[model samples]
Target: MDILYLMILCSASLAAVFLIIFIVNAKKGQFEDDESPAVRILFDSGEIKEKENNGNKKDEKEIGENNKIEEKSE
Candidate 1:
């Protein structure tokens, strides 16, 4: 039927468009460093005591400051 033909054509056109976009992105090297993000995460030292972790960072900072204070007091 004509309706079936039209549906098939629409699906084929969509598939072609998606394939073309993927090919273009591939040519642009957009996926070349996909593992760099994972590697970078693995290499992090977790030493950046962020301030928004609900008082933990503040407590650590206070502890550090207290050590310096105690050092000065000594």
Candidate 2:
């Protein structure tokens, strides 16, 4: 009875705090440009050149080399 009331009050206070913070930050434009991260990865990094120029095929070459190096130690 009293415990349930205390728990509800505590949760309501926490929710109010979070809601206020969210509204304040939202008005300040903190989340305005959310799409930038998902779009940014579409651009190339230097790894594409290594894969193309050497026919290195990064995924297979990297995994194979790592396995070979580990095996040599035993």
Candidate 3:
């Protein structure tokens, strides 16, 4: 039927558009840094650990100050 032919043409055109978009992206180095994202988390944890250590030191200093205040009040 004529309707079948029209449907086939529409699907082929849609596929061609998607293929062109993919080719353009591939040429632009979009996929080149795939490894860095996976490895970035590994390196970021060290920075997070450093921050946590600094926070703990501040907490300990505050606790020591509170204890001193309590002793003086008693």
Candidate 4:
């Protein structure tokens, strides 16, 4: 049917547009940093530890404040 031919042409045009976009991105070094993303997880543990330390410090400060308030009330 004529509608089938129209659908085929539309799909082919869409595929060609996507292919062109992909080729442009590939030439621009968009996919060059493929290793850093995988290895970043290994380095992020230090940041997590730092955040935990900061959180512990905050908790200690809050407890100290609460103790001071209790002493004042008593």
Candidate 5:
């Protein structure tokens, strides 16, 4: 029927629109750095560890100050 033809035309146009968007994104480098994102967690974890190490130093300093305060109070 004519309805089938209309449905086919609508689906084809929708597919074309999606394909164009995909092509534009691909050309604009949207998919170029796919590998970095996957490996980013590995590198990011090292940076987090470094930050945690730095934070620990501050915590130790605070603890030392607390001990000094306790000694003074006693």
Candidate 6:
């Protein structure tokens, strides 16, 4: 009987801790973007790559180097 009471108290404390953590996260906007993340994986990476290739955008390294050179010139 004593062991049963101890187990109940332990379980209740663990439940309260988890509940507090969930409430804190919920209040902090952690759960706000739930829909976007689920849908984001459905987007086609191949389509994104095709768009990037069509744009002829400079690579990140070249862009960074160009910015550095421009800053030096100014």
Question: For this target, which candidate reaches the highest lDDT against the unseen true structure?
Answer: 6
Model 6 segments more than 4 A misplaced: 45-74
Off by over 4 Å in 5: 45-58, 61-74
Q: Could you give candidate 1's per-residue lDDT for residues 1-74 as a string of tens digits?
A: 99999999999999999999999999999889878788887553425533334445456677778557756955
Better of 2 and 5 by TM-score: 5
Which residue pairs show collisions in model 3? Answer: none
TM-score of 5: 0.61
Question: Candidate 6 on 1-74: residue-level lDDT in tens?
Answer: 99999999999999999999999999998989879888988765657655765587788787678657756966
Alpha-carbon lDDT, every model: 0.74, 0.81, 0.78, 0.79, 0.78, 0.81
For model 5, what is the C-alpha lDDT against the true structure? Answer: 0.78
Residue-level lDDT of model 3, residues 1-72, one tens digit each, is: 999999999999999999999999999988778888988765535466457666775677776786577569
lDDT ranking, high to low: 6, 2, 4, 5, 3, 1
Where is model 3 more than 4 Å wrong at Cα?
Answer: 45-74
Residue 42 lDDT (model 2) = 78
Model 3's alpha-carbon lDDT is 0.78
Lowest summed lDDT window (length 10), candidate 4: 42-51
Clashes of each: 0, 0, 0, 0, 0, 0
List where candidate 1 sits over 4 angstroms from the true fold: 45-47, 50-74
lDDT of 5 by residue, 1-74 (tens): 99999999999999999999999999998999878888876543546545666677567777677657756966
lDDT for 61 in candidate 4 is: 78
lDDT of 5 at 54: 68
Using TM-score as the yardstick, the better of models 2 and 4 is 4
The candidate 5 region of ten consecutive residues with least summed lDDT is 41-50
Least accurate 10 contiguous residues by lDDT in model 1: 44-53
What TM-score would each prediction reach against the true structure? 0.58, 0.56, 0.56, 0.63, 0.61, 0.57
